[model samples]
Target: MEALEARVEALCEQGNALADLEDHAGALGRFEQALALLPEPQDSHPSTLWVCVAIGDMLFLLERYPEAREFLRRAVALPDGLGNPFIHLRLGQCAFELGDKRRAGDELARAFMGAGDEIFDGEDAKYLQFVRSILLPAQDA
Candidate 1:
């Protein structure tokens, strides 16, 4: 990682630690600060994906759906995002919460198709399970 990217990664890690401590506001601040260090039209930078995802996830946790959607959109526009199941999953969930059912289904389907067996085997296992339960049923409806 470049110096800035390394610093941003550290900040994001600190933010994650704060979130684990239930200090969401502090986490959000760290995420926002990390995001601010990147250039606009951020898809050019590989690091932008993680920063955007971090900020978007934090905003989603804070119930700022619109803001979350914006940041997550930035994430999905990055080159790495095309193959990222987690990005699609996050966008799908955000779209669901925003009452955009069609978009939610589209994103969720992409996530399901793109993901490997191990995608749901980590820290986000429960969330992926919940998403599968909800979105899979929607597919049949």
Candidate 2:
């Protein structure tokens, strides 16, 4: 178990390095390798949260929204996932791309409430605009 943990950590580091180099596909592969090493129920593994998020984030960067959404959705149900701003932000972006306006709004609002608009900084403006549109309406009403 310790060996596997070390391996996962190494893979995660490599994945992050690749991400920093703007090699999203390479990052995704490394993250996937780390994920595949986890036990049967990957969610039970502590690394699942970050690894899944990394994979989902890389996929999102690669413009694979549907696949990214699937991964982020699974990750959101894992430990410490619900209030994670990054997970919610990516999930929202994926949902928006897939034309799920209601879900996109819900996730984006969670993200905004958790980390504020800065989480949307690296991405496009439309997500923040959409979140405002959704939340502002409720606030006014």
Question: Using TM-score as the measure, which candidate wins?
Answer: 2
Q: How well is each residue in 92-130 modelled by candidate 1, as lDDT tens digits?
A: 778878888778767766777788445545434554665
Which parts of model 2 have CA positions greater than 4 angstroms off?
137-141
Find the 10 residues in a row with the least total lDDT in model 1. 116-125
TM-score of 2: 0.94
Model 1: CA > 4 A from native: 1-3, 39-41, 116-141
TM-score of each: 0.76, 0.94
Best by lDDT: 2
RMSD of each: 4.1, 2.1
